[model samples]
Target: MEIKDLSGMRKDYVSEDFSEKSLLADPYLQFDKWFAEASLVEEFEANAMVLSTSGSDNRPSSRVVLLKKYSKDGFVFFTNYLSRKGREIDENPWCSLLFFWPHRVRQVRVEGVAEKIVYEDSLEYFKSRPVISQASSSLSLQSSILEDKERFDKMIESLVSSGEDIKMPPHWGGYIVKPERFEFWQGGTGRSHDRFRYDLEEDHSWRISRLYP
Candidate 1:
C-alpha cells in the first residue's frame, strides 16, 4: 500500500484546557509544572525540543535536541563545541527553544541568550556520561567535513585500544540558555489557541500577561 496525504486527515481535540487564571506568575514555574506532567505521560520523546539558532551570516538553523535540565537560571543542553550549533553560539549567543507536548496539547517557546558553563561544570557533566558517548565526544571534530565515514569509528576504536580514561574533548561542553522571555501556547480547535507570555523585569522579577492566540 502507498502512503496517502494527511491534508484532509487532521484530528480534533477533546482533551483539556490551559486557562489564564491557573497560570503561575512566573512562566518558568508554570513550565516546571507542565514539564513534570509531560515527563510522566506517554508522549513521544517528551524531552525532545527544537532548538533554533542564527549563524554569523544571519541564516537560521534548527534541530531536535534532548533538553538536559531546566531551572530558574535557564535551560541546559550539551553539545560538541565544534558542531554547527557551537559555531553559531560562538558567533551569536542568542537563540530560541521550542518544546511541544502534543499528547497534552501544550507547547512552549523560549527566547534567550546562551552562555557557556565553566570547565569545571562541563567536566562534572562529562564524567557522568556513559563511556560510549564520551568516546564519541572525542571522535568527531563536530561540524567538520568527514573525509571518510570510517574515521570516527576508527578513532573510537583507537581510543578504546589505548586503554585510557576518556577525557572530555576541549571542544565539547554545555551551554545554558538564560531566558529573557517565554511564550506558552496551548492548542485549541479550529485555529483558536491560548497564549500567555512572561518577560523578565529590570528588578529580576517576572511580568506575565496574556496574548492573543
Candidate 2:
C-alpha cells in the first residue's frame, strides 16, 4: 500500500473580477445568467447539483440530483417520496442545494425550505417523461437495498414492454425548494475567490453582501 501526500497541487483561476456594478439587482436573474453561461461551457449536464439534507438524527447526507426546473419561486427535482432524501425532507424541510461548474470556475449555493409540489403538476411532468424513464421510476424503490439487481432490471424491462401506460406512483412526485438565501462564488487567481451572499429580508427583499474568501 502506498500513501500519497501531494498537498502542493493547485489550479489557478484567472477570470474577470465579479464586481458589484456588474451584478444583477435580483439574485434570481443573476443565477439565471450564470446558469446560462454554465450551460454553454459545461460539457456535461449543467443542471446537476448537490442536494444536501439532514434527517432527524441530524446526520447530513448529500447526493447529486439533476435540477429539473427552476424559477423565481424555487428549484424543483423529482424522486420517490419514500426515498431516504424524501423521508429526510419530511423530517426536516430545511435543505441546501449546491451547483458547481468546474469549467466555468464558478459555483452557487442555495439554502431553502423544501415542499412538495401539487400532485397534478407532478403527474404532468411524469407523463412528459419517456416511456422507459416512466417505467423505471414506476418500478424503482429508490434508496432501498437492492437484493436482486438482475431481477429489478428484468422487472423494468417487462413493464416497458407490456404496452401499458405507466402511471406515476403516489409515492413519487416533485419537490420545490423555496430559497431563503443564495450565494454565488467565482474562482480567482492567487487563491482569492469572489463570493456574494443574498439573504432574504423581512420585506421579501434580498440583502446582498460580499464575503471574504
Candidate 3:
C-alpha cells in the first residue's frame, strides 16, 4: 500500500458578498432565500443535504437525503424507519443537516432535533413518488447487508412489471428536523469567508450573530 497526497488541488471561490445587515431576522427565511438561489444554479439535486445522526454508541453517520419539504416548522426527508438513520433518530432525536452548494460557494449548517411526521403526510409523499421508486423503497431494507443486489434488482423489476399497487411500508416515513441553531457560510476571496450563526432563544425568537471567518 502507498500513501497518496494531492495537496496541490485547490480552487478560489468568487461569490456575491454576504453581511449581517443583509441577513433576515428569521433563519428559516434566510434559508429559503439561499435555497432558492441554489436551485437556480445547481445543475443537479439542489435540495440534497447531508443528514448526520448518532445512536447510543455515539458514533456518527452521515448520508445525503433529499429535502422533500421545509418551512418554519422544520426540514423534512423520507426514509425507512428501520434503516440505520431512522433507528438512530429514534434512539437520539438530536441530529444535524448540512447543505452545500459548490456552484454558489455557500453552505448552511443546521443543528436540530428530528421527529417523525404524521403518517398521513408520509403517505402523501410516498404516493407522489414514481412507481419504480415506490417499489424500490418498499423492497429495500436500507442500510442492511445485500448479499445479492442482482436478485434484488430482479425482484424490483418483477414487482413493477406485475403492475401491483405498492403501498407505503409501515417502517417507511418522513422525519422533520426542528433546528435549534443554524450557521450560514459564504465562501469569499482569499479565504476571508463570511459566516453567521442563528440560535433559538427562550422566547422562541432567533438571535443572529456573525462569526469570524
Best by TM-score: 2
Q: How well is each residue in 38-123 modelled by candidate 3, as lDDT tens digits?
A: 99999989999999999999999999999999998999999999999988998999999999999999999999999999999999
Query: In candidate 2, what are the lDDT values of residues 51-153, reduced to their tens digit?
Result: 9999899999999999999999999999999999999999999999999999979999999999999999999999999999999999889999999999999
Ranking by TM-score: 2, 3, 1
* Per-model lDDT: 0.86, 0.94, 0.95
Clashes of 3: 0
Q: Look at candidate 1 and give me any clashing residue pairs.
A: none
Score every model by TM-score: 0.91, 0.98, 0.97
Q: Name the better of 2 and 3 by TM-score.
A: 2
lDDT of 1 by residue, 1-213 (tens): 898888897777644667767888878789998898888884577789899998789999999987888888889988997789988988999999999988778899999999898889889998998777888887778778888878778888888778789988898888999999999988888767889888889998888888987
Q: Is candidate 1 or candidate 2 better by lDDT?
A: 2
How big is the positional error of residue 38 in model 2, measured in Å on the Cα after superposition? 0.2
Ranking by lDDT: 3, 2, 1
Clash pairs, candidate 2, are: none
Runs off by more than 4 Å, candidate 3: none
